[model samples]
Target: MTPQQRARFFDAAAVLFDLDGVLTPTAEIHMRAWSELFTAELARHGVQQQYTDEDYFRYVDGRPRYDGVQAVLQSRGIDLPYGDPSDAAGAETVCGLGNRKNAVFGETLEREGIAPYPGSLAVVDRLGMIGIPAAVVSSSKNARQVLEAAHLLDRFPVIVDGVVAADEGIAGKPAPDLFLTAAERLGVAPSHAIVVEDAVSGVAAGAAGGFALVVGVDRGVGAAALTDAGADVVVSDLAELLPAEAEKDGS
Candidate 1:
């Protein structure tokens, strides 16, 4: 990265990151779990349409679990009651389907452990060296578990995730509450902190929160889409934010 590009991050008071695609490859696991749940649910309901990756980016990715379930179900014109969070996995309700997906995710995670992306870890290390605090702001209830599995839980001192959002009545992404809350917890102003995310909804939340910088990591989502969603800058990996010399030194 150029000195100017690196300065954008080094000048920030703090950095807030989306846990899944940004820090770890768990987004792939999430996509698989969502596909498994929706494919079976659609098949059982005799729905003519099939679940696709497009559906994930459009309705599921980056949102709270039950909200994603509700959005996808609405697309298929299937209206299930918004069941209680404690509902059984197979129950015919929104929260039930979400819990079912979470079950699959847990099994997969346990069967095969996860690791943080090398590039993301590089950025985190660089940020820590520069004395900039960092936090995780994710829409997933499993954010803590994923971080622990990846051995990244200690890197982020503050995490604002789905459980906290639910308990505090904070709205999810595309509403700015999650990112704003993270900045607040970090004792940083929105205009002084940066948000790094791979999901369009997350980029929108950072933008809506008026953060200093909104960086979109294009794991799979197109650059154009992230730009349209309000990312101030877009890169394929977090390592690109570091100076070329710094990356080599870290290596």
Candidate 2:
């Protein structure tokens, strides 16, 4: 979309955001952790082909942890039991591998910390200035920790994350349940709200929810792919979505 077109598009009553790649750079952290865990596990299983960043986009990105593990394994024609969430990291089950990945992610996050993407932060600040409510809706169970670590926890009043989804038995993205739940919590209809996401599955979720707008943030994921996934518009960065007048007003 053109700058003006994006500006008008985001003049929404509420905006639901996917936390990692959309608002922050933790997607890199997640990619790294997934690579580490899958590399080790695949090697242990004598799977010669490597797990690359491409796999993350294709199988893991934007989905719940266990679901991601299942998706990636399925790609290799590998199947494991879907163990309970409390399964140990070494249990050799889907949930176990997901938990192991989460462990690696948590350690990396604590050691290196995280920060919101500058462009995303700018757009969010501007939206706040205009009194448009925004909520964080992410597939990560660590969404709260990531937000709190970035000192952005208070900026978003509602968070619908993997933990909440699990507790509520809501299916993860590429389903609309989580986003729709957030919209309902915000007292806004899907048709009046916008969803900002940087993952294809997330864009699909937003589109499935029948939201007023589905904005795809291109952060490694191609703009064309995002558009194909049902994004109404795609921007190189959220900063591009900020209005010129808002930018002039210190946005």
Candidate 3:
């Protein structure tokens, strides 16, 4: 869809947003933590390979942690023990490695904190003005914490994040369950809801969910990659998508 088409779709029903790279400015932090943990883990096994920024967004940005571990390792043609979540952060098991990465991410969160993308927040505020409900679909168990840190928690009333997805056994992005759940919670039909995602897998999920609009937030990824992965519309930031409505209202 073009920006006009996307705007037409958002004129009614709801918008479901991916939390990390879409609403918050912490995608870089996640990429860093994942890179560090995976690098150290591979080193312990004497692999000595590198995990790049390209690797992080492609394999894990919107995914659950354990799933992310599997994805990245699979990308590298390496496999390790599926360690327990209870295992020490440095432990070599997959779960252990994931936990270690979380510890690193938590520390980073504490040190750097969370900041909502100004452009994305503008879009959300616009939705509020238009009386369109919007919620967040996140695969991070820390979604609430991240929102709180960013001080945008109250903006979304229906949150479908990692803990909810795991507890309900709903598959994550590229599967559509989380996004669908958000739409359901918002009492909106799939065709009436829009999904704004910044990750490739997330864009695929929104497409798979049959959302009326799958708007991609091209933070660092090129626009073509997001479109190829199934986004209906791609924008450099949310602000680009909001001015039309503001203009219509003389606001």
Candidate 4:
């Protein structure tokens, strides 16, 4: 890493991470689940449109589940009632569709399991060694489950995820509420914390929150897009943020 890049980490009081694409490959699973849900739903309703990765990036990625459902449905000029969270998966309501997607995600996660990215692990390890705190700030209600599946639940003591967000009435990404909540939980000011994310919405949240740095991981999201979304720096992988000495030691 460049000296300037190294200083970004060293000078921060804490690092807040987005859970899915940033730290784990579960993002692919999420994409599949979303595609499955939307494809079937669109056909059933004869919407004459197909769900695609572009839709996922534009309307779903890094946003709260119900919000994503609403956004995608709005894109197709379809409207549904804002159903209760307890609604059945088969119900034709916003929360119901969101619940349906989560069910598919849960099934896939159970079937295939998950693991953390090696580069993300390396970055976390180095942060641990340096005594900088780390927390997770994700829009997924399944953040804890994903972390536990990857055997990383114990690493982050401060997790502000969808469940917590709902319980606390916090807004989701692009509003900065979730990331700001995490920094507060860690007792670090937003100005003293770094935000690491793979979604444009998450990067925008970090920027909106005035974080010390916003590091975007380009997991299929182009570097230029991330930069345009307000990332201070963009790397294809978290390992690229490691210092030269730490990189050699890991090697």
Candidate 5:
């Protein structure tokens, strides 16, 4: 979309966001963790699928923990038992592998911490100036903790994260339930709200949810990929979309 087109989309309604890649710069951490766990485990099975940075964003990012496990596992042509949530980490169960990945993700976050996208924040500030209420929709149970670490918790009062998704029996991204729930919580119709994401799965999910705008923040995946995944607009940085309010209002 052109710059004017994107601005118009934001002007139409409240915004809903995915936390990890769009707001907080933690998507790379998740990619690293997935690569570590999947590479190590796949090596044990004599499989040689080299997990790379490119693969992470394309296949697994923006999905729930267990869904990520499934994506990586399917990539390796391996099918493990869908074990119970209590399955031990590093075992041959969906939950176990997912839990193991989470351990790695947590360790990485502890050391590297979180960072925010100045450009995205700029657009957000403008939206606020115009009275557009934004909510967060993420598949990570640690969404709140990460936002707090980044000192951005004050920006969003309504969050639908993994905990809420699980408790509400809502499926993860690409299913539209989670995004839909966030729009409902914000009292905005899906057709009148915008969803900003940095994952292919997330862009697809936002589109599936019938959001008025599905924007892709391309930190890694090329703009073409994001576009193919259903991003009505793809941008290298959110800064390009910021209007004057966020640039010089000093808010």
Candidate 6:
């Protein structure tokens, strides 16, 4: 759809944002960490093929850590035990590898702090001024940490993240449970909420949940691909959906 056509769908009373790529630029950090971890581990196992950003988008972008590890490994015909979440980072198990990745991500975050995309913050602030509530719906257990680091935690009153999803037995994106849970916690029906996601799996979940609007933020994912995944509208940035007046107000 054209930008004008897409702008009409942003009028929902509630907005649910994906934390990593949509609000913060941590997805690049994540991609880097995943590449390093996978490249080293795969080579350690005598697998010569290099890990690439495509591997991240295809296997890990919207999945919970262990789920992502398993998916990527399985794609390469590698198998590992599904160890418990408490497993140490050094353990050669699925959960351990996930833990290792989490450690790497945490280190990267601490070493180089994070900030919300200016456009995202502008739109989020505008939503509040307009009396529209917003929540965060993400597949990362580190969502809270990332939000806190970026000082964006308080902006979102409800967060349906990987940790909450795991504790509540809600499935991750590509399933509608996580987004549905966020909407439920926000006291809104799916039809009254807008879901802003950058991942294909996430857009699919929003569409499957029958939300009022599924907005795909095209970070690296192409518009056509996001559209095929059920994004009702696709924008290069959230600011694109804001009114000229809101932009001026933010400025």
Worst 10 residues of 6 by lDDT: 1-10
Overlapping backbone residue pairs in candidate 2 total 0
Candidate 5 colliding pairs? none
Clashing pairs in 3: 83-94
lDDT of each: 0.94, 0.91, 0.85, 0.93, 0.83, 0.89
Top lDDT hit: 1
Backbone clashes in model 6: 0
| Off by more than 4 A, model 2 | none
Clashes per candidate (backbone, < 3 Å) = 0, 0, 1, 0, 0, 0
Any runs in candidate 4 off by more than 4 Å, and if so which? none
For model 5 the TM-score comes to: 0.92
What TM-score, over all chains together, does every model reach?
A: 0.98, 0.97, 0.93, 0.97, 0.92, 0.96
Model 1, range 169-217, lDDT digits (tens) per residue? 9999988999999999999999999999999999999999999999999
| True-structure Cα RMSD, model 3 | 2.1
Candidate 1 ranges beyond 4 A from true positions: none
User: lDDT of candidate 4?
Assistant: 0.93
All-Cα superposition RMSD per candidate: 0.9, 1.1, 2.1, 1.0, 1.9, 1.5
**Candidate 3 error regions (>4 Å):** 1-3, 244-251
lDDT of 3 by residue, 42-76 (tens): 77666756778877878887788899999888877
lDDT of 4 at 172: 92
Tens-place lDDT per residue, model 2, 1-251, is: 58666666567889999999989999999999999999998888888888999999999999999989999888877878999999999999999999999999999999999988888898888788779999999999999999999999999989999999999999999999999999999999999999999999999999999999999999998999899999988988888787777667767
User: TM-score: which is higher, 4 or 6?
Assistant: 4
lDDT tens string, model 4, 1-251? 46888777767999999999999999999999999999999988899989999999999999999999999999999989999999999999999999999999999999999999999999988888888999999999999999999999989989999999999899999999899889999998999999999999999999999999999999987899899999999999998888787788993
Question: For model 1, what is the alpha-carbon lDDT of residue 203?
Answer: 95
